[model samples]
Target: MTVSSSTECVIVKYEGRIATVMLNRPAVLNALDEATLKELLYKLKEVAGSAVDVVVLCGNGRGFSAGGDIKSMLSSSDESKFLPIMNTISELVVTLYTMPKLVISAIHGPTAGLGLSLALAADYVIADTSSVIAMNFIGIALIPDGGGHFFLQNRVGTTAAKQIIWEGKRMTADEALKAGVVDEVVAQDFPKAVREKAEAWLQKPIKAMVQTKQILCEGNKQSLLQVLELEKEGQFRMRATADHKEGIAAFLEKRIPVFQGK
Candidate 1:
């Protein structure tokens, strides 16, 4: 079955166990306005509540996103009107980053500012070789928001993250890949790569994958002992699932396991 979300700037389509999320405002390179940001958050929440095993996030047009809408910002003078929208964006970053379902970002064209934040928050990021990537807040006399600092620093280390944000240069896909910003750089056929990756992951034990993701996402903040304890607890829980039994049986039988996400 296939279903599309009724959102203004964001589109969500679910097929089988996979949900594809698209940032759909093509005219401004998918630049997010207040309505768009709220819609994206709502869609993410809906996806999290559903039974989707994996999520693939991408933009609908030539660019992923140009970040927050500058026009909106420029027009608004009252901090009250603006701060709520900014808060929404932050919530969006947190939702995408910590979602139980494994999230993959397919980036192309110009991705910068909060747009890059959204991509980095995902579990995996795949970009086209010709894509322009940046942390571009410096150009606007602003700093990276929407957890951009945390994501960049986590991926590429502190110094590089700082430099990337400070310089605010448009980075080539090769440069971004070398910096460990994105997981894969596809020379061509960006959509094909995303589909292949989503299909591959969907075949595995999804519940186990989500459990592993939870532990790993919290790994940095915890001590080794705490991480080990989580691993132990997680292992204990996973051991009792139906998927685990199927996996063991498949291994003994030398056949593929069919995981039902139980």
Candidate 2:
């Protein structure tokens, strides 16, 4: 079932109507690098065109994803790489949001920033109780990217989304469920429950499910236009701050971020 990638950044498995795309970097807590992001986009694009009735996104080991690869990104001498990489990450989430098939994220551990955006873009999000989900961009003096602002606002509305993203608060799976960020919180029976849900979804007519997905996405599409514009402006402003640089550095140093709120 494993579909090998050219870059070996992502692994895909197909069984019946479901295609499981695994983020394959367990060594670094599945932290996303540029290549991983590109491979994920490519894999999702490929799946969208296939006969796959549903897609399940998950990570291999401890975490869903630790967001971006701070070590790799910060170690690079070039700052010019940031915008393009962030844009591609944004496109990946947008792709997930607009995909025709039913998409679900099975998040077990930490899902932060772009990772949380990816989950929120899905039709349903299934998280384990031990998981931590957060927007987390403000901690780095950056605004939400990877369509985080757009997807989060769609789920939790403007006020809650503002508090979550602006405050960069880490939410428990139960809290995320209450906030509508997670559709289900499965503590002990996650694997079985997720499988049952996916199997149940596959029982219905694929076209009907697809159309329903389209209708839901269409309802939210108009809102993304404004959300994305505001998010881009926020990122532009955040990148200019000294705290942003310090935040990234602090993350790499494994120390607490000291943001002056500048």
Q: Scored by CA lDDT, what does every candidate get?
A: 0.79, 0.82
State candidate 1's TM-score. Answer: 0.80
- Worst 10-residue lDDT window for candidate 1 reads 223-232
Each candidate: RMSD? 18.3, 2.7
Question: In candidate 2, residue 213 scores what lDDT?
Answer: 80
Tens digits of per-residue lDDT for model 2 on 4-71? 33346678889988998888887787788898999999999999888988899988777788887767
Off by over 4 Å in 2: 1-7
lDDT for model 1, please.
0.79
Model 1 ranges off by over 4 Å: 1-7, 219-262
What TM-score goes with each of the models? 0.80, 0.90
Q: With candidate 2 superimposed using the best TM-score fit, by how many Å does residue 260's alpha carbon deviate from the native?
A: 3.0
